[model samples]
Target: MRQPDIEIYLKDGDQQAVTDWLNATIGPCTPWRRQGQTFKCQAANGAPVTWLPNAVGKWHSLFIESERTPWEDDPAFARAAFAALGVEIRCAPGGWQEEDGIDAADRWIKINGEGEQEFIWRTQ
Candidate 1:
């Protein structure tokens, strides 16, 4: 199956923070199991997805990956989760072609709070 172009970015929290939020809300939709250094879950299509606590290159980032589904499969699920946590967010739809001719993120989520923080998703 071809995955949709979807990705999620978190700007205000670390992996544990995001994980706790996910597990708290919509966890019933899909539960996660902690692996050695990451949390693992399966998409509705049975494709594996992972959430890394300490992403090497990116600090305090949580990523979602699945072979069968785009990260945007259920954005509302995430929005609701964030809302439940009282976090304000602004999302920018991805798929923008930059002036540099480089492919940009498929989606960009900006957290309205202290510190300059945002998350982006790139899908090809």
Candidate 2:
């Protein structure tokens, strides 16, 4: 099957980095769930959110949309994506960061802190 769009978000709401990534990849998925959207239910992570997954994996997501996704941000999913990816994403005073690095044995996206985020691509 074809790959789906990858998405990112800035707490700052600049959308520049997300836009750049969008241009290079499949496409960006607009947030169907926003701050004011109707409360569908409390997420597994306990975040009050709206919307549900329209499809399964293939795209990178900044937030959790479904239990099928394997992201550490979605703590209660099947297994911690961190466990599968072997990368630990942590949050600190600065921002979201990752130091464990993506594991060669698995696929992971680590969150190191809350500010000044970065990407550690597979090649690097």
- Best candidate per lDDT, number? 1
Instruction: Determine the C-alpha RMSD for candidate 1 after optimal superposition of all C-alphas.
Output: 6.5
Instruction: Give the whole-model CA lDDT for all candidates, comma-separated.
Output: 0.47, 0.30
lDDT of predicted model 2 = 0.30
Model 2 TM-score is 0.21
Regions of model 2 farther than 4 Å from truth: 1-16, 19-28, 31-62, 70-124
Which lDDT tens digits does candidate 2 get at residues 21-85?
Answer: 32233233344344442223333333332332221232223443433222233322212322333
How much lDDT does candidate 1 score? 0.47
Q: Which stretches of candidate 1 lie over 4 Å from their true place?
A: 1-5, 12-37, 43-47, 56-59, 66-78, 87-92, 95-100, 103-107, 113-124
Give every collision pair in model 1: 94-106
Clash tally, candidates in order = 1, 13
Please give the distance, in angstroms, between residue 106's alpha carbon in candidate 2 and its true position after superposition: 27
Q: Which candidate is the best by TM-score?
A: 1
